[model samples]
Target chain A: MSAGMPFYVSPEQLMKDRADFARKGIARGRAVVVLQYDGGVAFVAENPSRALHKVSEIYDRIAFAAVGKYPEFENLRVAGVRYADLRGYSYDRSDVTARGLANAYAQTLGTVFTQESKPYEVELVVAEVGDTADGDQIYRLTYDGSVGDEHGYVAMGGGAEQIDAGLQQDWRPGMHLADALALAVRQLGADPAGGEPRTLTGDQLEVAVLDRNRPRRRFRRVQGELLTRLLSSEDPTADVPVPDEDDSPRASSTNPQTQRDSERDQDRDVDGGADA
Target chain B: MTAGPESGRLPSAYLVPGSSSFTEFLSAHAPALLPSRRPLPPQATLDAPHGTTIVTVTFRGGVVMAGDRRATMGNIIANRDMEKVFATDEYSLVGIAGTAGLAIELVRLFQVELEHYEKIEGTLMSLEGKANRLASMIRGNLGMAMQGLAVVPMFAGYDLIEDRGRIFSYDVTGGCYEEHDHHSVGSGSLFARGAMKKLYRRDQAAGDAVRVAVEALYDAADDDSATGGPDVGRRIWPTVGVVDAEGARFVTDDEVAGVVEAVIADRRDNPGGAR
Candidate 1:
């Protein structure tokens, strides 16, 4: 080791350097997105292989997304899912929020990154949509174990800066999936010279959502032909999917979407109510 | 229970610290207690009963999961009405192929593990986490797989966030792969998969998906002797499960009977399948 140095940088500087290092690493991967819809958020990503997905759901209302090393990110995804599920099981499902899950993941990642040399090569996002339109929360987790509470919309992956700047133009409170997806695709598809936004079809991209109208649990993947039709649909928000008879949807009076859901449950509650 | 090769004292493995995953915890405390951690013949491959044809298709608002009632050993029909599929842990169902006895044991053990996790940790693991845990358990059985007693499982469950069901397929060695739209596992998978390719639709209703499953199982049994179809005369049919926001619900025998009856009636009219 070299002898006495000027030591201009402070402890805070060291942490900032580490945080920046971690952020840069996260910025080098393909961008992942989580867009809030009427019922929930739709997470879409540009992944080629059908396997090694960059998206997953951690809880009933919480979905997880990652961009970086497949195994590393996948490990984190599994852990987050486990943690969220465990929390939901321990407490009420409503208690499992993006903020809590993101914090847990951040702590684990940060510990590994600092305690171990090979930092977890992944950046993740956890999203939870509330019963109300204003109850949505998106939490971004960095590779070095830092958590950031993101509002409105957040983007992760290699070209996030370029992608975020692009999404900034159209991202709004009530943007539907078609426009939201178009914005995501455009940012992901943009070339170096910034030609026409690259076209991303259903086969090339993965999409999922947590609809607002749904009761307690949210999280449903919209993929393949569904993705195709949704991408082409003019108003996906208007076409709120009705709850299947098989699904035991539970929504309180607080949620707008539950207006219909509560009635349905009430009918069932009067009928063959309890789960045998 | 654990025993060391030389040093006794319940084995040092039982005293080690590790992840709370019951699968991993078992791998350390009593490796032999795991399905994949057993000794077997040089060539475990034999005329053992192999389960067939499980299918899952997502509908507009929910999803439908199903399996055929057949188990075969090579060219021999081992059992006429064996349930090759089962609901392992609520909100999730697993269909097995290869080594009937072992597969059943693994499924039962898995069910216990999930329940145990919930009881111990005070929460159920996420659908994805459950899948990974299964993968690790499968990996631990690699030794048995090398001997030919392989167990491949098809996993399907609804993700509350995505609001759509997800399916996972795995190899004997525990490689977890996610299937996009629909998937099948077992001896008659190829034929069943082909049937799904033609009939499955994103807009399919849960009832429609169940019909598609019956049709697929019929097709699988038609081509593969290892696969089984509905036995109307004996009142035996496929064991089916569905998972959505409500949770995993197995198709009652009565419901299966209704679908099987309708399917039989349909097949009686058109031997070549109705589009």
Candidate 2:
């Protein structure tokens, strides 16, 4: 719309401008977690509502999630559900995989961020379970719509780095649902003595999983006393020493401190798939 | 093919904020996706499996609606214990009398449309808005209905604000008409309604309502071949649910078993099924 501007701009400049705008908006809100567990993934967010939910089934296998500005993300959620349903209706349900859905969201979010005046101030995660037990995959998409492939665990939100650091030593394979859920909660929970003063309940929190026992429908909200019971009952066997107080780094938009923060494990786990 | 999201070009309906009715949105965007868009071959009378009688009785807290499980296709009985009725939405249920496939599709789409509206707008549509939306959906399928496939579904749901249960009936043209007191629809509707007339009480409780429904369905099956009674051999019974102030909750298998057992006993003692 502006005159005197060249018809085309460099892809680098375009991408840079879009990313900056998206990062600013997203940094303003809390984050959500998409934990890839042994059987499937669980999306846990510290939302306080029995009726309103952050996690919902987009389809049989696919799910839609957001952490900031509910109205904006909710619209995306509905759209994602529509897209998924239509895709499944048109083609086979299996082909409507999580990766494909993430790509679609990336395309739409990236397009809006780059072309529209205001970018969506939300972050999303699209996860899929593979054939074998260990073939689960989680794709974390940032505000700028840039997609990141995550292994074992992926964290988002403002204080993501702190939690990621918290998970650095504790997260490991063969961790049961209880361990994974408790670890996730502790990572995101308010500190013993901290700045925020808000009490959360089992009903306030939302949890769901792509369970091995359950048939096609993997998305279910674990609510009220049930979730609270599960969270409190988890045995804290591998509680990592709180991120060494001295080494704790602030979370940035790009580096919301995923467990990969420690370079040692990054090479081993991130590339552990290369051998396979 | 329906005009799905893949087509970047949305119908004019997408741009404007129209009525809260999601069925209207579908009508404008892609009518083909709606159940009534399909064309059907004309016929004098369809001897297909006609779903059996539904009974809705208003009670103290709310209302309970139930139907017998039988679908008779001409001289030969077809699909004994077929569930002809279902809860269309959270607070509402639909019972079909015509083609099962089309009716099921209509019910499923109605569910999706409601969900879509709720997602787009944080709140659920009013009971009236929901009823109207279902009507429009029925209208969309008028094309197929004219040929021979007509679906008349009985809808019942609770109205939280009003603190009552509302049941609705529809014609082949998608005309929605609210039913008062007790109502029944299907081939055995006459017999079912007669039974409901005798059994129904204005302030019936949850249990009494279930018994009334069972009695009505029994009468329908006794007179009409299209209506099926509880099958002890197959362990199949009428799928029933209650619509009260809380919400529309289906009767569990165990609970249905209890009610059907009672109905079987009463029949054994008094074959007429009346006190």
* Error at B54, model 1, angstroms: 24
Local distance difference test, per candidate? 0.69, 0.67
Clashes of 1: 21
Best by TM-score: 2
lDDT of each residue in A1-276, candidate 2, tens digit only:
588677797889877776776666665566567776666777877676756666777765667667767776766676666566555434445557777778777777766677677778788887776644577768888776789888877777667777677777688876777688877777777553466744445665677765543434455556555566666755343322222122111110001112112333424553212110
Tens-digit lDDT track of model 1 for A1-276: 557667687868776677677667776677887777555687889887676677775666778888888767766665565555444433444566777667667767766676665677788888887876688888888777668878777888877877778777778877766677767777788864566767877888877777776654455666665567667756353333567333342222111212123434534542212111
True contacts kept of each: 0.02, 0.02
Tens digits of per-residue lDDT for model 1, B1-275:
12334422122232233354656655555456566766666754666677767777777666666777677777777777666555555567777777777787687567646754653343568889889878877887788777777888888877766777888989988999988778888778899889889988878788988888888888888897777777778887787767777766666678878988887788786886868
Task: Report the Cα lDDT for residue B47, model 2.
Answer: 59
Could you report the DockQ of all the candidates, in the order they appear? 0.04, 0.04
